[model samples]
Target chain A: MVSATPTRERVLAILDTVKDPEIPVISVVELGVVRDVECGPDGVTVVITPTYSGCPAMKAMEDDIIAALDAEGIGGARVRTVFAPAWTTDWIPDGAREKLRAWGIAPPGAAHDDPPVQLRRAGRVRCPFCGAGDTTLRSEFGSTACKATHYCNSCAQPFEEFKAI
Target chain B: MSNRFFEYLLRLGDDRLVLGHRLSEWCGHGPILEEDIAMANIALDLIGQANLLLLKAASVENAGRDADALAYLRDAREYRNALIAELPRGDFAFTIARQFLFSAWALRQWEALASCRDADLAGIAARAVKESRYHVRHSAEWLVRLGDGTEESHARAQDALDELWRYTGELFLTDAIERELAHEGLAADPSAFRSAWQKDVDDVVARATLRLPAVEHWQQGGRTGLHTEHLGRMLAEMQVLPRTYPGARW
Candidate 1:
């Protein structure tokens, strides 16, 4: 009977084990993709927000959530995606930034406190591998929709920087 | 009535879908490796936005159609994307010019939509405004570089701008449906964006050392489901898979 109705905390713990498909080092929880987890008489509904609208990984993440709950014997689970608050790099936990940097993908720079007009100018991005500030934007778009390509002059490495948006 | 709102959503979604498809064509064919990745990334964003918008449209229609069904099953005549989106990806200059013009206008459209009365649409717009901001900056920078670069690049950029100017009018056309939505604060009046878009485009063109051509005749009709021949061919390629194999999933 306990297995049939898992607590929200238990569901969350199971979700913490679900890693982002693209960046395997961080769990979706750490990435802040899991927006909400509501336990109701009907079922458990997990609300997720996509990092980017077109991110191919969203479908995979949704499936993983359902699978993880099912594996834990927590049936009647549903995954819902919401875009109201919208996902931002700011949602990434403090520790996850270091994890992403150590994994070689430069985490996003500081959030856009400045107006949008100033965003046209490239922000200072430190090299994830070398910790150097001398980097130039190679392209606004990168290997993934959530990233931008940058060339680190200090280490002579072309790296992907998770875009601040 | 929800009919106008449904139509409005389709207009927004179809534009992004068709434009995304066009940009996706540059996946491995970009002039530079960086450009290849950049174009693909933008394509992903546009397509993603299209998915969300179409899903909202489907819900509004309440016709039991999903985003995939609307995106993959729609015929060419049924599509409401602007003619500018369907124009062939000519050269790098042409593609960049088209993107610049579209992004400039889209940035403002999304900004207005962000504050509209519809919460769901506002949410989508709020998120898209950020993406569109980046897109405009990227394309604007490229416009400057290509226009002010080599002699050949300058001429190509000029020529592309001239050819594409005629289609820009369609973007700002406000039909009865849009006017009604705008009056109700449900949708933005595209005509109101003209001055801002012009200023934005003019600033970029001046910095790029390119001239805005004197467009004599303006082409319009994509909003009403009338499209150029180009859309038919593009749809043939885009819709082939779903049309051939019904209910095929990845």
Candidate 2:
């Protein structure tokens, strides 16, 4: 008899339905938090990477993954977190940036290659609200560790920028 | 699984836990909203690191105790954090100076640990190094600003340095556990990072136009589980809910 076990693709498809608790607009897969899905004889393992080392949303994301898997009748699904080759904003899926912008959160800009001094000078982060480049950083940390708070001089609107780490 | 390794892990984990708690005290009390958010972010980072380190320590001990048990249940004397970490959070200048000193030392230690033989530790260290770099930059920048900003700010920053300087010697003091782990390639020698820490700290202080306090008496003993009176109060507040409602879930 052939086993009716869920395939890795099916598991991933199920995960696509799981939204990040903090950012409901993005699924874990689109955010690159879902690192891998492996199926084995004994069980299925879902590997994840946290966007920030201190992200409080990681536990919620993990629980959501497990729940999503179980809802699909996928038993013995385990979640594993890895830290090496640490998660980067670059891992964010293509077109997700535009989605993030549409959702009112500014997408992360390119990773900085400059020294700390140069990096401290506010980079041109186009405002999601006003599409203006005259935004200034109010704080390196925002409401979450993964974001930076910025204010657009043009629109006079305060926004959170997903910091590239 | 070695006792020495277990002790070493506790030392590192406890330092992060205590300092994280101290920083968390500034949650809603920051002088400004931006600083408030930054302090909370750094606190969260430190707490997250403590969770990982304590979890690793539990696994190494092979004991039934887990991270929560190790963190929230431990008595004051059972903690192995540095005395500097347990000291009360003073004014904003004091907090910034304390963070600058600790982050400077921790950044060097993490850099060395990233190359250690233990893969798990190296991975943790590698991840922590990135965060610590940002932490050091933040604290150092604050130091420069506070030192050069105004007469009052400069005096306050210098006073904070003087008061906190004595406790810093404990960071470089090595014991048998550290020596054994260092010899085994599982841990980095604390003494090895001292000069680097000193240079980095001195550079920041110099740029801030602040002078380092003269070395007089050094305070120690937190690594051996002897902390000041402050840690007990802090832990009492920190562990109350966990102890009161065992198995409480958020």
Candidate 3:
């Protein structure tokens, strides 16, 4: 009797064990870099797209994916990068958004449901420190390429907000 | 015709290479830490674009030189970048203004370039247009905030506009190479690009509550490689390490 689950599906199931080092809220799959999974008689090939070219996170993510799947008894896994139709913030899963809010960080103002025309709207981000909606932008650039610094008026604390590129 | 194609690519690549070098100098000196990282990120993107385009230029020219040779070994007079890209990174406001202006124009240029007759140019343009779109957005966002934020910021931004305005005209000046390329469907008409660029700048400026400088005598000659005194200083800094150790690599 054949097992009901396909090999590719089993590989993805194993990948869910790997968590993002910084956020630790979601696995690599929620990040949307895992574009496709293919399994053959020889081995399994994983196709991942980078959020940004030369992103440092990509190397670590690749290693984590490989290590986790190898522990699951699938030894021949190959990772490849694709650049066409580049990855966007919209690809981030809904589960990650909930995790971010629970972690005391404001979910990014840019949501996937919004059209491109709505991109010009001013982002009304709540302060991560005091959970206040009256935070003001201190600077557009942040500690990382993905975050920005903002000061909360309520608690008088400064915190980082993830900037939607 | 192929020479012209290579020439066009070199001009574009050199603009990015020089500006990237200027922007990198601010890696640690930005007004804030976030901005410091932001400028560094933008600098890296620009340098990456330069390498891609320069490599394409070398392949098209079939010259023995690769991207590195074309970038480092070339003399000041050999460079064909416009004056706007070569100007000093004067102040934070100045840097933002330069980026806003260049990125807007470049976004349009890359949009048109994506459909070039050459397969390589089209592919490169397609990849680059997305990056330039983000660059324009980032720079334009800063332009709006600084221009409308406070009296001091408004004045400083306007001053940057005034100082940099003279260099904008040369960006739309068509040359013999451009003319030849356009006829072959390999380039965009510079004149056709001006009005669109104007509309873009005007919309941002209006939103920022700022005004443009009155049309003034426009400077020219960067296309011909005749540069201001600043180029000498910039080249001295950028090429010094490479020139000192001819083939050394880290």
Candidate 4:
């Protein structure tokens, strides 16, 4: 028999186990697209808003969310999408940023506090490999939708930067 | 509460779907590897936008036909895509011209749509505006490059502008449906966006050293389910599998 943990606590616990496919250090909870979590007698419904619609990891993330919840006996949970107040980089947890850097992926830069009339210059990203702030962007798009390919001059390594989606 | 909002949304969705299908035709035949990938990515983005807009439109219409049915099973005449989207992507210049004009107009329209009275429409609009903004920027960047690249490229780019200019007027004109929706605050007042779109395109054209084609006797009636011959061929390719095997899932 499984232990009867409180619904909200159980859901939160399940979410903690849902890791990002590319970078294993951070979970979906840390990524912060999982906007609302509702638990009730019927089941749990995890309302997740994707960082980008074209992000390929969304399917894997959905499967992970379901599996994690099911492992805790929270079966029959419906994962719905809510796009209102569309996602921004501000939602990523502080700890996850460190984890991404530790895992050799440059974390996203901070979100602009104010909205500017003109397009701002692209953010400067530090190289995760050598911790150099002098990396040059090779391509705005990389292997994945959420990442940009950059070459670190100091480290002499071509690495992917987790672009703010 | 207005049916016009649903109508407006379907028009937007259909335009994306039609154009996306046209672009997808070049999956393996793109001029270069990078271009092929870029076009494919843009196609995917447009198709995804179509899905969101159509699904939301269906939900609001309370129609039994969901987005899949609307996308895969609609007849050619039943589609309400703009003439511009249905026009063939003749060359790189033609495709870029279409992208430039469409993306510029879409960015302005989506900005207005983000504040729609309907929450669902507003939600989709908010998400889509970001994507369209990127699309516009990408196309605008390319426009400047190709328009000023070489004599041949510049000439071709100018010719594309001349060819596609007629279709630009259809995007901003409002029908009874749009007018009603605008009154309800459920849809963007397209008329209000005309100057903004013009100014945006003017800047791009000025930078590209290309002349803006005059809007002479703009073609209308696309919003009323009328479309060019290209739309029929497009629908045939896009709808074949779904129509042949109804209720099919992948």
Candidate 5:
């Protein structure tokens, strides 16, 4: 039986059902974009952050949060965005990373905050399709802001890398 | 209300907005498919940052004006963007050169602002610091490539750098508004990071084999709402839809 009021856990569980609009395989909570969830007498407040500053998915995610809560009869829900510690791809947990790999997306590695910018980002990204280490970055910028395009030489398949930061 | 803070925010927001619009012009017209995507993505980031900054500015003004209103409704004369940002996107080399110069300065600017006493500004700046690092790397890499690519590419890159040098001075121009904010530790002082910016830019230019031009006369006035006659034309195209049907939504 459902409780009379939405608890923090309840709101969080609902949010877990809300998948990222860009990558539908992982939920927003799994992606760690949902910072905090609060439920009070007024209503529930879903505090979220953007994966990228200009990620178009942010609006969709916000709307999706509201819709998900509204569907559960949680009224007067509010969505707030806070950018303090800055979003990093590292926030995506190990379970979520495995899901991303299964979804044919190469999850990001450690997001080094202080690395000097390089002409070409160094390192080998294993192809998510065939688990091949031979891959070349086709473009640092990809179909989306948070992604980069890579060509797998071993499998001869094109893949997307969720960029590290 | 701190009028100076509002104006300062506007300056920061307008700079990104104008430059983002200029970059977006190359959406489909890029030299190549990858370059096209890259510019558009960068444009998205800049526009996103501008929107955030402008939203904060609107709240500070407490005038019921939203980011869109402040962005599309304001006249060119009312804009606070520096002249360098308002300049038209010239050639690919020119674009890359300007980007390198600007991003070098901006990366440091965001780094300094990350420590701002104002929590809101600091948060925005902190996020921006990460993005700006990418911007600097991307533009600097291109600058080096273009400068060393071939005779024609090198010459063009050098020419662009020389032509854009005069406008660079305005980026470091500070006034009473900025001075007060800096004193309060709520804002970054441009002069404080000037040397670091110069060193970073010089390093990239030298790597590219491009010589930095010495400006006999530094261009100014964009900070004071005096644009270089280019912002109005861009705004006309940008604001036309919003003006034609007020309150229009996509």
Candidate 6:
């Protein structure tokens, strides 16, 4: 945007300003939603992947990305969604995890790459607020598809964990 | 696109659409607060998958109609979902029973479709395969909990499984449409996953102390557009918004 040619770094910086509409603290880049930013002769194309298959925030995120690019005089940007390497919590970097924990959301545990259809819901999530390890899963799904609701037995406070997808 | 392919996409798309709508009905009515949220989340995933798939089908058809048009415009008789999906959302047990049954099959089916010859189809399936794993686990865990819980819960879960067992056969049917696509490597062989699905279901059923009903006449006609009376009513509710407003968007 600074050079009118729209360098990848500039596009990423702008995208960093575009926080995920659902989880406002974390930028899409930090969430690993913005897979790539391609600046071609045609124009800028922001490639993104959905955190969940039916995440409603995706449209809002797409619109926000285009709007963010357009604000810097970069118009006619295209937002494309790809699903080859499916979006995972593994994409969320550690610094953003700190931001999420500070915001009272437990960051996701490591994602499993093994076969599907396991019975037991594995892993324990400590409370982001009290850092209590004695947390019980209140629900497998939380307010968003990417998260699950949990209750901390130690502090008696409710928290959400970014589900390990 | 060939008529066969269009029809095939409808079958895939409609299953999610109808079932998603049914699950959405549980939004405010779930037995527990967590379940209400879970049902709505699952519904969102299904409808989201349906949106992507039906959009692809519309593109292939080269018709002016888009995914919304296909989903909102189509009537009950025109719907191609399996009968098992269109069955009325009965009790909480019934809902979990159907979820366990179908998600088990969908897990296997989507797994096969994950490597489909068509890139668009494969991409959709690959992402959905991940979602289906959670669906299978969530529903399967509930099936066990409810089936093994107490006298009342066990009875209800068993009764629900018995009533819904007949419709499970329809999913495994490999008719000409599926055969043609499977032959071309564009679709999974529907019958190929039946045994694995059975084992998966049986394992959970056994753990839950629930009994599968003795095999009766397998109900199979949903593929050919023959559905139960339930589909028409469900479609009437689903299509009402689009039909009434036409191009209305919020």
Per-candidate TM-score against the hidden true structure: 0.96, 0.94, 0.75, 0.90, 0.97, 0.97
Give the alpha-carbon lDDT of every model: 0.89, 0.87, 0.78, 0.79, 0.89, 0.89
lDDT of 5 by residue, A1-165 (tens): 244668899889999999999899999999888999887766788999877778899999999999998898886789999988788888889999989999999999998875444566779899999999989987778889988889999989999998888
- The prediction achieving the highest DockQ against the true structure is 6
Docking class of 1: medium
Model 1, runs deviating above 4 Å:
A1-4, A113-120
| Pairs of residues at least 3 apart in sequence or in different chains that clash in candidate 3 | none
Report the error of model 4 at residue A155, Å: 4.4
Q: For model 3, state the Cα shift of residue B151 in Å.
A: 6.6
Candidate 2 per-residue C-alpha lDDT over A24-139 given as tens digits, one digit per residue, 9 for 90 to 100: 88899999988898898878899987676678899999998998888778866899988676677887865888888998889987765334221154456889998999988787
Interface RMSD of 6: 1.2
lDDT of 3 by residue, A1-165 (tens): 132323877888887778766667777787777889988765778888765442556778899988888787777588976544456667777778778767755666663322211114376688765678887876655554455678888999887765564
Model 1 RMSD in Å is 1.6
Please give the lDDT score at residue A156 for candidate 6: 96
Q: What are the per-residue Cα lDDT tens digits for candidate 1 across A1-165? A: 464556889889999999999999999998889999998877899998888878899999999999988888887699987778877889888799889999999997766734333326655789998999999988878777888878999999999887787
Clashing pairs in 5: none
DockQ per model, Cα:
0.63, 0.49, 0.17, 0.39, 0.69, 0.73
- Per-residue lDDT tens digits for candidate 3, residues B103-136, read 8888778778878887766756665665666577
Q: What CA RMSD would candidate 4 show?
A: 2.7
Against the native chain B, what TM-score does each candidate's chain B reach?
A: 0.98, 0.98, 0.97, 0.95, 0.98, 0.98
At residue A144, candidate 6 shows an lDDT of: 89
In terms of DockQ, which candidate is stronger, 5 or 6? 6
- Model 6 lDDT tens row, B1-250: 2677888888999999999999999999999899999999999999999998898889888879899999988877788999999899999999999999999999899989989888888888988987898899899999999999999999999999989999998888888878999999888897788888998988999999999999769887888878888888888888888888889987
Candidate 6's residue-wise lDDT over A31-145, tens digit each? Answer: 9999999998889999998877789899999999999999988999999989777787888899999999999999988888545567878768989999989989888888989
Ranking by TM-score: 5, 6, 1, 2, 4, 3
Off by over 4 Å in 4: A1-5, A22-25, A54-56, A102-104, A113-123, A153-156
What's the number of clashes in each of the models?
Answer: 0, 0, 0, 0, 0, 0
